[model samples]
Target: MQEPQSGPDRRMFLRATAATGAALTLGGLSTQSASAVAPGGFPDYTYVRTLLTPSQLKYNPTGEIIFPTVRGVYDKLASPLGRYYLYYAPHDAPGGICLAYGNSLEGPFTEYPANPIVSNKWDSHYSVSHVSSPHVLWKEDVKEFWLYFHGENTTTRLARSKDGIHFTYDKVVLNTSMMPAGTTETSYARVFRHDLPERGASYVMLFMTNNTTDHRDIGWGWSADARTWTFAQTPLVRHSDVGAINVGGPHLLTRNGSAYVVYNKDKTSGGDIMITEVGKDFSLRKHLGVFYDSRSSAPENGRAAAPSFGTDGGVPYMIYEAGERLKGAIAVARG
Candidate 1:
């Protein structure tokens, strides 16, 4: 991957051609007419403060090798049972998905004794060299948990777990062949379940795809059963539109009858989290501006990426990867 340019062009771009025609101008910089704040009184990106540090989760007692050394925790999910499930890739090469559990967002998490819950060995459709970036969702309709992840940054696979811990390989949900022509890889998938008045109730997915030039962009997909997906050929959130070399790690949060697409911008070494409202049709609306800038102060610290949203007692919060990839840690920010 090439280094991201550090110019004014590196900022999030707001296109005047959106459906709502709502413009967002931050301090007279952007040309949009709307404010950068999200609906339902969601705080601006500058207000995000870290609640947990990587060191707090580094110690694992289960004797299962966790994300050893500098490898950081990648993504996290807050279960309805009041327990937090963290997903990470071991620091070593060919790293697979590992799990840790804890009672509090800030806590001494316990690595699962049976670590690497989903590994490359579990799927044969893709290379068994690496499998990481796991995004797990609970399906209330089926009463089962679904795990969507990628391997070698090439393909995405899905698995199902009755108890959210033990998982069984279901199928390959996304592959290069499923993408547009000349697409080389697909990864970093985030799934959202919503009942839009226009589209009805369905499972929506936002995934990253890298073209032949290695530029990654976000794309949209939909599924009726969460097993089979129909992906769009055109990019939903492209790098050209975002003004970043790469745009990925998509996570969604719905508020006040509107859906928001939160994703990472630029390379992992110097990226920031950005948000944009999504219309009923899953189209990008107003660009909400930076959610977490890596250069910001403590709690809002580091190169934040792979952001996952949750709520604690009705208060919104975010869990993301902070600092450099291998040397980074998982950090939380409360809204």
Candidate 2:
């Protein structure tokens, strides 16, 4: 990933992409499919649904177990595994993304061993692998795997995995903080791809960014190869909504022409999960409020860490983490 830059610079990339006619488009939000989840629509899947929570993971079994600083498993890419594949920062090192496997929809999962496919700064001084949550990318043309995630030194890195178990290559794609020393929100990035599947060859690099200076708002990046990122010229979303502050965790999910962003809002004042419809090009649509909050008072089980678009019980669902200790488990929301 490229080094992080100013918010204006980032947003410019997005605007330029739109001008270049290389942006995304969406139809709109739909309850038509998510509604069929339950019998009478009694909130069949409001929040408590999960494919694989942390309680099921053993160790970093496969892929990248990358996560954000939000608490539990963070952003995950589209992987169609029966269970949810969470990415997290383990052992208090910088961060890392890993994958776990489950047998059932709601797991008691068993993760791939050898935790930490990528380690914090690779056990070095500057720290190159202090990796964060990763969203996977599957490129049919290259027949290779792309793992996009955040880094502590204030940058997002990318890695290539051939078998999904062992990685082959890696690099940073976001901005490097030019601040005095530290005092930056750190570099964060996520991954998302459109389903249109143009015959040509292309990829989308979704990012997790912050203005850091005046705390402008969460920013983004646009990349075609996942290595050289052009900070989005315009923000895909804002830092707050309806007079609130804080916005992040850009989980872009597309289904049947509509793209949904499962992100966090008001995190400072008791965070809650919210969903919004966005055009393929990142235009805001229906603001679906509160995708899922704490299921119960139970010690605050966890919070919305990362989110990914998925299918639970044949219904489209967005899976996220709920526990801070990974024991609470990951949560899912349909419709």
* Best TM-score among the predictions, by candidate number: 1
Note the clash tally of each candidate.
7, 51
TM-score of each: 0.75, 0.66
Cα lDDT over the full model 1: 0.64
**Which segments of candidate 1 are over 4 A away from where they belong?**
1-40, 44-82, 123-127, 196-201, 267-269, 296-302
lDDT of 1 by residue, 1-335 (tens): 22123322222232222235654444556454332333334653323434334354443322122221111112223333226666665434466677766665554456666756776675355557767677787777776778888776778888888767788888888888998789988887877786544544388888889988888888888877778888889887777776788987887777777777878887535678777787666765677667665664443244667777655456556677765554556666555
Candidate 2 TM-score over all chains jointly: 0.66
| Candidate 2 lDDT (Cα, 0 to 1) | 0.50
Taking every candidate in turn, the Cα RMSD to the unseen true structure, in Å, is 8.7, 12.8
lDDT of each: 0.64, 0.50
